[model samples]
Target chain A: MSNAERPDGWAITSPRSDRVRMIASLSGRSARRKLGMFRAEGPQAVRSLLEHRAADVRELYLTDAGTAANPDLLALAAAAGRRIRRIPEDVLRAMVRSGNDAPAGATGSGADGPVSPQGVLALAAMPEPGLDDVLEGLPHGPLTLLVLHEVQDPGNVGTLIRAADASGAAAVIATAGTADVWAPKTVRSAAGSLFHLPVVTGIDPERLLPALAEHSISALATSGYAAQDLYDAELPERSAWLLGNEGHGLPDAVLQAADLAVRIPLAGSAESLNVAIAATVCLFETMRRRGGGAAR
Target chain B: MSNAERPDGWAITSPRSDRVRMIASLSGRSARRKLGMFRAEGPQAVRSLLEHRAADVRELYLTDAGTAANPDLLALAAAAGRRIRRIPEDVLRAMVRSGNDAPAGATGSGADGPVSPQGVLALAAMPEPGLDDVLEGLPHGPLTLLVLHEVQDPGNVGTLIRAADASGAAAVIATAGTADVWAPKTVRSAAGSLFHLPVVTGIDPERLLPALAEHSISALATSGYAAQDLYDAELPERSAWLLGNEGHGLPDAVLQAADLAVRIPLAGSAESLNVAIAATVCLFETMRRRGGGAAR
Candidate 1:
């Protein structure tokens, strides 16, 4: 919900006004870059940001006329010490992105578009995922990682991240040129997985992959036409799953740079799979291998 | 696509007229149901209908300019022995649905929306799918089958069917009240899979599963909540994959009807997997088992 003015304290009212027309225009990558801020909507999204970094949050909004008076959101906001602003009901309706439209074509009435609700839409600083090294020796969790490269669609990016979360991946690396996972739609499509997983953005694997040569992590990139079948590859104890553009798939440059390039075998007449579907297949395949008793 | 009409012929030009008004209100499922027709836009989608006898043959339109020049489409229309009506250009633009709207989090200038192309919108009769007895003896091939029980999302239905085509599934069966797999969005999302796959709709599993049983085809439903894991399940020598509703999964009635309800194990935070994902996992797992080795 961009377009809201920043009132002095933590409260925001009637957000998404023409006053913040810049934020709406910031739907462009160029604009998001200019502001160093992006938008995220819905109760779940706002709550995820609060749980992670309350200090980074600036303003919060709730609908006037007792819209978001529910105890759960209130408890979360109160616990985070975030003040709430009262906005007109109509104000909150326009704050959502279109894909939030009806759950990806769930129904005919287009209920997935933005809904009017009394909820908190907050502004939080972008996450700092730190260096790649942050994942090293992270307890006893599954040693999984999602490496993204120049993926263009925010929905696919978000969905991929969501799959990664479901499959227990530890982090996502958004190489330069990929959609920003924090951009509102990607964040929303991710269904709050953005906060659950560590995301490293603006990476140039041209430079980053070389630095990990010493680690035991197997660097595998997904390609539709790769020579090595995904099921046959010797998966690493810990992994780095590299994905690239939806149509182009992995660039030869990146594929050559990776430790190995693997592909999910197909049995159909269709040319290729959707970017998100491909990512999920690769991510879950790794998970299957690990749980099936592959000695990691 | 809707306004233009010429029953029993192939489309020629990419017309922009007439069909524009028809699709706006016809955007939802109820409207489509009332009309007894659905929208089909884009060259890929148009080509698909020409290729398949799966649906009833009906009206076809093409822009005068795009009609005369595109020999390949002309050849296809001729092969199908259908007539083509040409329309205006402006009407064509308004008819195409704009998909690929940047999802919520991505900061991008453009958003994907509904696609209703003006070039060639067909008013085709929905196909009456294969009966239980007709499908009992599936022809020889890779032999993949999609079974749905009340899957509500037309888009997901469309997408899964498209994936079935891409992954090479042989036929798709939709249980009672699931989204019409042949509806415009499902057709569009399917990326022409309906042409290649025998989509048997209005399928009541009580009648069909038993038929499949008589044919010695094991029917396995994908269950994230089930006790038997997919990797561990003994997939059939020949089988059908059953996918359930997006909200409530396959009914216990149907699950009990199935020879086995196999679970797709998850190691991550998602309490449940999407129906499409779960189905794809089940299908691929079948392929894995068919490849001659037990999966770990």
Candidate 2:
């Protein structure tokens, strides 16, 4: 609905308002980097931010319908002592559109347009956890750390976060050239696991690998050409899986540096699994071996 | 590049040409149904079709650069005795756009636009395997059959097909309301697995469950609320995993109809795993139990 037709008490209605534009600008990398903030859209992500990292949420915008539909989220934000602004649908749409990197004149919605935020969006401070902090917090026992090397798909990055969280990983690390874990698509696809786990970004693989070894986390990589089968590989007590880019598998240098390279054992004609799928298989295998498969 | 700038060797240059439009029309469900054909975009999918299902391939379209970049695919297609039509980039783009379900005027390219075909597309007959045929052909020993009930995302459907193939399932069955297995996005996300295995579509779960029972294939469903843990469940000799929709999951009736309901045991706060991810975990777990995880 247009802003003019909104009922009373709508705090924001104009899509062109400065506030909306500012939130929209968060869609760009430079803007997010400049502001040290990113946009988290959809009720699931906003709710996650409120639940796990409420202090990081800078501004919360919800449509009247969104508030009505997600009273529990509203309560969580209230409990966090955060102010909630009710916006008109159009304003929310504008904010969502601005965050969308789609070129101008794009008309598709859902399948083609920017993700539908489900009437909720949040501008939150990016959590900048250092590699040292992540390492320090690591448990002495068996643990898994997912390392994405130049993985460019935001969806893959995000889904891997959720998978890691599901498989009970200690943390996720992204090397240089990987998709920003804080990107809107990643946030949505991650389905709020970004809040559940500590994610460190921007480390160079060359440096990250050796640093991980210092922590006793053996680096593991997957390859289609590898002779070692994943099921037979003896996973280390502390493991760091090194996932490569989408189009190219791990670079030779990275693969060479890996402690071990194993194949997932494709039974069919598919050359490989989606990066996330392959990672999950490895992660779950680690979990099962570490006794995570037992009933909690 | 514009069609006018292309060399004269191009067989098709005009996007508006009747032949181009005919192929473009296949993007729509009705058109695909009417023609009994579907378009498989990108070199990976076309290569698989030529390699595994060559007799089903009706038309092959490639660009000059595509031919050079994917000589192996070109060679495979030629070996299949299929005619290769070299089209200009504009024609390829137009065909890609027509297959895209994006609304008119949507300008986004990769992230927003329809998926790029990666320099090759093929028109091929849809493989219509029946449920009984799928069951009859099932291996007498340990086997897996992935069943999708009303799952609607094309990418998820495609990925599940690939996951099932990777996990070495006997076949994949989709219920009514599920995304069309032959859709362009499904074909792409499925990578080449669409041609690797038999997929039977449009079976009612209520009927499908009992039919599988008659064949001694147990029906299993995954749910967050289930009392049974997947890791401990006594997996049947012949298993069929029932996966629900992306949003609603399995209906109560379908869930009740299944022989067993087990949870994947989320370690974190994620309400559930993505349908494809969850399905893969189950498929792989079953594989692991049936000795599929052992080195080939």
Candidate 3:
């Protein structure tokens, strides 16, 4: 069908169609990089894209039920003059399956299942801010940056983004080896926070260090065995907190480059906290120190 | 083979055998209730059970590799005069599969996949502490308790327990609608903290309130929209913090019953924090207030 020929808006029916396959391919890193776009599924993420980053949204796909369920999103997309394609649920499901190897009808509830299709999907241009852009865009207040080094879990990466946003962080820098922040799973877990702040990805540690120094942003590395407690450490007005991988933690070279090492005191017997939880604790501690404790 | 007849110390080879079936059935809440036992899988959980709660361990199932890898656990079980049954990897895999309906030979990496067999399993008597028992066991210092109201995710429940332990909470109380604390997944997520503190499960809200009052412990309920911010709220020295379900925050009855409703201030546009993360933030904030900031 021609782009404007559909009588009742464009409808995609066949899961095996060329367009479906092309959309499905975006799930992979290479495909996303080549296409310079990523998919954001579910109402919340799509709404956030349309509302905050509408200029980046390329296409919107929705099931009939999805359209009915998300009136605000549909209206917002219409207001942005974006095309909306109504797709069958099975076709949407096939798109999700192409990206992930989850069993048919998995619904995203299972532990290893890819995130649920959530009945709506949008293709959007990937945001690729440079490291200099991130450092230069800092607000006038004390800068708080979150630096994630080699953190592998998409959920953890996304949660850190959300936590960073909530803690009033100026930006997030994901160094080499971190999960793709624009990946669908990360987008969903981030809950729209990805659009709120500057996010620079694929940065090397060597490049990241000098930029922080140039900006006078002191970097603090989190370690379970560090002698200095987080509360006791002298947090800088402008600081970057370095978080590491889930299993092995930050490499010694990264820790050595940090301005200081800090630990959260554990009163109980847990060997350690989850990486995301640890970052939240540190981020909020910094916020608390800056008199960010008063609530609205 | 008879229980005492195996020259190799009673090895189970068949997945359908009665012993294997019984051990696998403990994955269900009804089965655990009827059998008065639950399964703990993986080397860490089994080791914790042997080292801390050895008296409650009824049987230890291990593969040849598991036995070799966990000599300290074997010694502890042997010292406790517990029985050990060695099984092949397939039998352990089958036991996990039977309980979780994961595809045959599915090594537990999928979303719905049960935890991997981890080459070890142990059947232990359920630790069913009474509410009175939990209250009485609080340390002489100011008491800190965690009350989970109908929280359903096994991982979240387990993580909360671990966090509670790390924050030095005296005990955890899981109300009727909460996930089974002894489930294999929860046990794995808790990372052995289950044995480090008193955990009381299945207590009704009515019973919990009177117990808290009788102990002179104040209760704080967490709400995302509470008028009082968590930072501004005067957290009691001896208090029980109530966390609600994943989808719904605390029920109105529970909130109305609380001494105060407190919220964590969010500076960004994200709607809310994950339940477990919220609990950790609150618990650690309480710890910081108690001067638990000094690390070893």
Q: Which candidate is the best by DockQ?
A: 2
For model 1 chain A, give the 10-residue run with minimal summed lDDT: A103-112
Q: DockQ of all candidates, in order?
A: 0.28, 0.42, 0.38
The residue ranges of model 3 lying beyond 4 angstroms of the native Cα positions read A1-10, A24-27, A98-100, A104-118, A293-296, B1-10, B14-30, B64-71, B98-101, B104-112, B115-118, B293-296
DockQ for candidate 1, please give it: 0.28
Is 1 or 3 the stronger prediction by TM-score? Answer: 3
Clashes of each: 49, 3, 6
Q: How high is each candidate's interface RMSD, in Å?
A: 7.0, 3.8, 4.4
Tell me the lDDT of model 3 at A172.
91
Better of 1 and 3 by lDDT: 3
Q: Model 2 lDDT vs. the true structure?
A: 0.83
Compose the digit string of candidate 2's lDDT tens values, residues A43-67.
Answer: 8889889999999999888887887
* Per-residue C-alpha lDDT of model 3 across residues A13-73, encoded as one tens digit per residue: 7998988898878767788899999989888888888888999999888887887787777
Against the reference, the lDDT scores of all candidates come to: 0.65, 0.83, 0.80
The C-alpha RMSD of each candidate to the native structure, in angstroms, is: 6.7, 4.0, 3.9
